[model samples]
Target: MIRVLEPPRLAAHRREPLLNVPPVITVLAAAMLLIQLVRDWVDVETGIEILALFAFIPARYDPSVLADGVLPGGVAADAWTFITYAFLHGGWAHVGLNLLWMLAFGTPVARRFGVLRFLSFFAFTAAAGAGLHLVTHEGELVPMIGASAAVSGFMAAALRFMFADGGRAWRPGVAEQAVHAPAPPLMDVMRDRRVIGFVVVWFVINLAFGLGEPAGLVDGSIAWQAHMGGFLAGLLAFPLFDPIRRRPGSDSYSRTSRF
Candidate 1:
């Protein structure tokens, strides 16, 4: 009799939780759903009132507009809209897409950054997104709501560390097998074909939305400018949020990395 070798096999039941979405993602998604439920049950007038209080209105930054229809929350509410608006969404589709993206892209980031750092990164990108929108659409009364800006930020940050130097995007459950390599240098990322292609595609899609009607996909007009702001913020500010640091005289790849 001759002995034969075989490849390793996984247990049939071990396929569950393959993607490993973080608990923080669950919390964020739940919050968005709950808020939407509340908004749906409320009367039309009250719904408008809620949007007024929570959504990011570019005109809110202008004192003249706030002088008339402002909520009773005072300046704090106006200042905090940058953070609150991200939690609200215009419709079910809007919230669903944002939640799905959060689970997919945000999982790796939260896993790498931990809860506190991940939240800080989220807050920073959200505010940066709102700031950019204010710059372009100043004094506009249209309310901007949704998580696309923050989600785009996550995508940008993921691009920095989630892909190998060879420009191959990492797949789910393969982070454990990844060769311990430092994130590509910023200049290298700019030159990478994959990165450039992704950026171009994202820009074209956004430009299309900016130029024409969204065909009822989202609840209202998409804020592509805010999305760009968040993407740029994450791409440029990832170094501040990244926790991995090389110790003196030690190889950076010595420790195992996980997404």
Candidate 2:
């Protein structure tokens, strides 16, 4: 009896893990959560003291306020607050919201920039956000705290490469390749309709928050200006942080991984 040859068995497809977050992202998230936990555990006076030392209060820069010595940490707090404010949050809701966005946007950025560059970029954006906030609300007594600015920065930076190569849809096993793909020139990115739409929507939402807070339409005072500052900084300064090199005489970049 002649036996027919059997077709080769296909290998079983490996399932993708539910949470594919990078270690740096996890660390950053944990740090923010831990800080919030400490804030929650502390007494009212200590909590206020924590905000005084860590939160970014525009009035900290005012000569008059500095003279009064109302804020703690003196000269050093003024310097550190720009970066430290990013770690503080208004409440659990605030921290949770920031982490959700951070996880969404920070994942690809951490993957692309690696730990050091990503941290540097984060600090840069956070400080940039604080700087703009200082300018807009100079001498304002209210303290600004949250990671929204850095999260906004990551969202902006992600746009640079996420929409490249015809804007491939994010799918398991393909996200790594898409994120690693060559980032197109900024001008080309601006020209893309998808990018334009995203920018428009982002700005509009921020504008709404800015307008709504004054009108009592919004519950909390969102730092929309800081968000804009971070977004713009990320969009313009992305090249400075980007690890992938652009090919000469070409609009597209090379796939050489610097991380």
Give the best candidate by lDDT: 2
lDDT of each: 0.74, 0.80
lDDT string, candidate 2, 176-234, tens digits: 66567667789988998888999999999888866666432222588888898899999
Alpha-carbon shift of residue 4 in model 1 (angstroms) = 59
TM-score of each: 0.86, 0.87
Candidate 1's clash total is 0
Model 1: per-residue Cα lDDT over 102-201, one tens digit each: 8877877777777777888888888888889889888888888888888888988877877654554364335533222456667878887888898899
The whole-model C-alpha lDDT of candidate 1 against the native structure comes to 0.74
Error of 1 at 86 (Å): 0.5
Clashing pairs in 2: none
